[model samples]
Target chain A: MASNWEEFYSSHPQPANLSKNEDLLRDFTARHLNGDTRVVLVTSGGTTVPLEHNTVRFVDNFSAGTRGSASTEYFLDHGYAVVFMHRVKSLQPFSRHFTGQKFLNMLDLIETKDGTSVTVTSENIPKIADVLRKYKSALANGKLLELSFTTVYEYLWLLRSACQILAPLKEKCILYLAAAVSDFYIPPNEMSVHKIASTKPQTISLQLVPKILAPLVSLWVPNAFVVSFKLETNKDLLIDKAREALNKYKHKLVIANMLQNYRQKVTLVTQQSSYVIELTTEQSRIGEEIEMYIVKNIVDKHEEFIADRSGRS
Target chain B: MASNWEEFYSSHPQPANLSKNEDLLRDFTARHLNGDTRVVLVTSGGTTVPLEHNTVRFVDNFSAGTRGSASTEYFLDHGYAVVFMHRVKSLQPFSRHFTGQKFLNMLDLIETKDGTSVTVTSENIPKIADVLRKYKSALANGKLLELSFTTVYEYLWLLRSACQILAPLKEKCILYLAAAVSDFYIPPNEMSVHKIASTKPQTISLQLVPKILAPLVSLWVPNAFVVSFKLETNKDLLIDKAREALNKYKHKLVIANMLQNYRQKVTLVTQQSSYVIELTTEQSRIGEEIEMYIVKNIVDKHEEFIADRSGRS
Candidate 1:
């Protein structure tokens, strides 16, 4: 396992497009901070761990980024400037509302002598328009900035870079670490340069991924409200693990959930107390997402944290 | 390693949706065979090997289903009925033309007092309409059957089931195996029942997955035209490995490709000879895909194989 964050960054080469993305991010942050806008960094989707340097195959976490993508809209609605970092090809805000064959199903095609035309079906227009309006508004105001990464190494590098930029903003920044990051990864020196041959039985050894949250909480953005998610399959261990993470990282919150029922229920675990937030059957049937409630609670908690810090100063 | 295919099948449970999908496949094949139409089974995308039965994380091959999805369209245009079996959410024939945010980017949203509407931009209408027409025609003619799988076990089960239904047709059946299947997997008994906790360094032991191609060639569809893909990162081993597979399995063909330049070049290897197919920069820039050539060659070979068999009989 890599014990030092600096060493880990040095050992792994930066992603080819990191500098370009960093420049864009820097400008976005500068504009938001200058306006005295509270910025929320929402990390979405899963990070991949390549088995080979060339990466013919990799280990992936199962995340469509629904939680983070859905939450981004709520943050924007609540007047927070949003930095949306996600996995490439994973779901994104606004785009998440139209996936699979949904967009195609909603449109009608008309052919004429001149050419063909496509239009959204009459019944679906109002619904699609609402989403489009929010999406366009965010883009127009430059309140939303999108960045993407594919591999675990890229994710870590980008996360640190984001924290470095957000750090100076102090309590005005909120880091919503919702991405399902890989806990284990093959070291750079240990990974095969080429695709591993399958002619014989192979054993893959993975080292524990260093807890970057440790540095991010204690050093990078100490005053920022940091919220992390703890997803577990075993119900018995869910709250305990979330509490443990809170104690160890000394972060503001750990949203604990079981994999099977995460969509319906989640527990907000903090240093002081724990509370469950769940959706009723009726609410879920009517297409009410739990992220709305989750974001509302986080926003309230963040307000209190900021107020407490200001009073002390 | 599982040397016996039957034993391997017995050890793993069938996919939960296999029976439902098989019913659809059987009806589609039976209907097409009665019409004397040649049927091609195109397996696309990558298979996932779950580390846990609950499956929070999995080992996945690097494939966007580009080869299989692109080739499916070619096969359809050539008057062959297509069975597109792919990883869930990977890609589809018509949908491949619009992925990520491309579909949304091509549209213009209009708002009014009554509601809002979405229309394909005038410039993009002709292109979208052309694809839509092809998609609608395939459905109307019942020439396309879509089935999906996520895990390696599910893929293996569905592949065997598809072969069983296609076996009686003999020379009319084609198996285009383009899916990036995993070489190693954890057996059901060995897989964790819950999500694997990542509190410490972990060692994951994987057994060699049984070579299903052995039975698929010798037993399941002995007379069918089978074309498998060999994707390698090392240029030196690409052709040699393809040849080795051809020699061992005695399959009709092995399409060999190096990971870096796969879109531009590929070598088709047979027992008798090997030939390289390549696309120039000008051709690629004009939107020419290598799959078009690849499918054409496969179709010609399948025709020759049928002719030779008929002559012998």
Candidate 2:
């Protein structure tokens, strides 16, 4: 509805933090290019579209980054170096375990005549210890790099930079695009500089956000195994739309999900065949995530892809 | 632009959590009605408007609830019962100090041959101890009641219920409505049940959210000391808009602040005159907040109003 992706880059100013994050991405990619362990860039959470220049209000998506955050941990468990790019304030890999108010329940405050102190309750120590150990292990091994963005502009800019950095690894890299990106945005030229006063009925015009996956697949990180997602409210449209994305973008696979029961099941749509990785009733009830199976499937396929590329070469 | 506030309520279904939260409000207010101390209902954070029926997206405001959360602690310090109704996931009292990634840095993980354990490192214990003590004291005394809402519809419904429950307190109650409420929203008929397709340019019509303060001040809790807020990106409109709101709503005070330096300063506007409360350069450098002085001023005004009424009777 407005400009092409390149024009969008030229017109909009680069995010102030882009250069700093780019440096981090470059360093992270450099370290992970050991050829022994494959690296994956997993994008999580949702990008916002600010309606105003001085943004007091913006459009947001309802992803808590559960799929991405949970998936990052599973990917790490499989010994993959993960560059976890997420929306600011959304869930992260390890911290996601205890971010809610229930975190307060874990700590016991002690009072004494001398002063005060805080200790993890005897009952709660095991869970905290487990998460903390894994988090520290990830940091010590330098296997995880975390980056965050809030707006669509920042996300796109950072995504491009990350892709360029990871492209050197060729088929050894995997690009997992899971962030719930905005489909529409108010163009920079049309956005309000001040708060839109609420004096009367207002009409807002939104332009179609340029499809970044097209360029992301073909131009950026072309050799990487690209897996995109399609989430729909209507069950009938889910697989068809996912297949459409796979055909159009020419990516490795499409993960199709319905908004109603995304956690319980996800369909993997590929060029040759499409199949589902579903959680059994017991597995779901006992707190088993579908991500464990999804990651296993992807790791297996990625192995085949790398071997196939080597065989062809 | 749409129907009146009453009509809006009748048309929209009540939030599922309303009755549960109402019980909390009733119990909290009943316990605080001992004639020993006053109570304040402090609404914080920002209300959202869902864009679709099955909401993958919504409109959100940019308030981390720094003001409301900080003020809740100060109000608790002053021995006033506090009802902290806020937007879900926004910052809250005590916990706001350490919700970020730095929370991880506070603990040291010890891995030994026996097993693994975690502890609060010596350096970090002091700060966490202080916050934990205060948080426990408030909870133990039953002085703070926390409630949360996401949508504007839920916010309005909850506000009315809280007001009805607090009306019995008369002049002893204060309603500090500081939440960054949305000014406009889409009607039910206009919103898409599924995600809005982004193949073309789209037009979204937003109707003005009816001014609930009109009914709130005149009918909801007429005897309570009510305070509202006006935040402006433009400096020139700040004071004028605050005064306009006071004249229209006939509330006790309006806190006016420029978006740029809201943390550093704010103007307290009443019918008689306006005065500024600002943090000194020394205070600002050491991370002193302006809410301390603002809450002090409001407490003074509330005390005087209570005394005046007592004398008249």
Candidate 3:
């Protein structure tokens, strides 16, 4: 049975450092509310469900924070302040483009008797410069705030804290929830204190994770533009699920993606209409991101949303 | 019931790029066999068990590949050719030092009208230089071979391929199985092709993953020295579990650790002798690592094992 969101929060303890993060969130949200700029809270990456209290084993949703991280960059370019809440080690904006050995490989060492100097190889200087300039600019202007979480418990706690802190922004705030949060989790009460033994067959019972969107849309930030994502392996269930979520939650949009081609294509589903955003084979080959178009469409729609509400008032 | 290792191999299709990885492994092993250096195949990081064939969700072990990555660097220092098999995005030997924003933060952009030059800041130069020099030297000497896997299926297949390739090394080979391998897994036939519905409570049944160490010890690379790791959240269970594994697999050693303080302390368990390798509080506070001590002990023991066998022959 699905648990009550209120009861869920009450039953589960608040994650460590929730208040501390909330302080940062409040400060960031307050700073943006004073400005004419729009604010976006982009929740990225996947949430983990620990099978054991100390977490020797866990169930994880598959996400590298690609959509959310890329979308944050686009949002920043569109003149919005972004709070990037992501999994601890998942990809982040600016740095996501160059990962693994690619980062180190771009560098060269120049050693002299005086000292050693590390320089970006000439061939890779342009790309590094572009990314670095943007990264430095964002930090310099205080346009980006980063927060991280690992487990589902921590994610939910942080999300609610962010909502309360962002509540003052109301219509000016946007919640872009691209995180692949676990829909089922082993609650703390049932989790083993130690690592589960390997000697026997294991049967793991997972309870339904209470739908936080119910409370979030109605109680937390009703006037804010909220966007959710639905990922599937089977394409047939994609649109129906996306539309269902939109109708049920009365949210602004649902981005539907198939697991196989998520980076290349996604569907933007709204209450009024549904549209497809895809990268052509050549565009994909030449390194075009579907998120570029996705973010553009959403930004345009968000303007319409803000205007419509102001007209109603 | 536990499935036989041979049947398990036959049941699951080979991982993609297995043949390609095997070819690389063959070449690396052949090159090392021609040389006088001992080769250690160090498996690091955690393995995943996909809940769906399309892999929207997976069961994962808790490991950042710290022990394995750190050990690989130490093995290189010990004059051993190293095969570093790890989880795709987990920590690596050299690059592990700088992760997340730390890498970007260490860099400075020097832009003139002529062009832009990216340089490591003065404070970070010494550390980056040290790691880079070692990294370059290892690659230049062809003493390091890296292979990566994301899932348990891929790890197992690659491991067996590596064993077959390294068998010719005989007593000169060391299998340092440090990866936090999953003990239970849902069979491929039982996994969902689509994302599992989250509308209700879910019960996942996992069977015991076949013990590959049995075949690894008896059938493949029988003459090679092998070491396995056992981690428990409870310290009381640590030594017993390690000894049990040693007795069962008849492998050369088992490194036992408590998950809570693994980096600070580890116990080396062998048939006739068991000892603890620990970092003092002062050492840990000073950023000293226990892997340095662990690797030194293992390298010394490895030499003794090789000499003992040669003397008997």
Using TM-score, give the best candidate's number.
3
- Across residues A50-136, which tens digit of lDDT does each residue of candidate 2 receive? 988988889988788989998998899989999999998888988887774566657877778975666778787788887777788
Which portions of model 3 show Cα errors greater than 4 Å?
A1-3, B1-3
lDDT of 1 by residue, A131-202 (tens): 877887898889999999999899999999889887878899999999999999999888999999897777
Which of the two, 2 or 3, has more DockQ?
3
Q: What TM-score number comes out for model 1?
A: 0.97
Task: Indicate the residue-level lDDT of B120 in model 2.
Answer: 77
What order do you get sorting by DockQ, best first?
Answer: 3, 1, 2
Query: How many clashes (backbone N, Cα, C below 3 Å) per candidate?
Result: 0, 0, 0
Tens digits of per-residue lDDT for model 1, B1-313: 4466788789988978999999998899778877668989999999999988887999999998899999999999899999999998887898788876677678677877975678888898878888777887888899999899998889999999999988988999899999999888887888889988886777788787888898899889999999999999999999899999998899999999999999999999999999999999999999999999999999999999999999999
Candidate with the greatest lDDT versus the true structure: 3
Q: Estimate each model's TM-score.
A: 0.97, 0.97, 0.98
Q: What is the lDDT of residue A111 in candidate 3?
A: 90
Best by DockQ: 3
How accurate is chain B of model 2, given as a TM-score from 0 to 1? Answer: 0.96
User: Interface Cα RMSD for candidate 1?
Assistant: 1.4
TM-score-superior candidate, 1 or 3: 3
TM-score of chain B of each: 0.97, 0.96, 0.98
The TM-score obtained by model 3 is 0.98
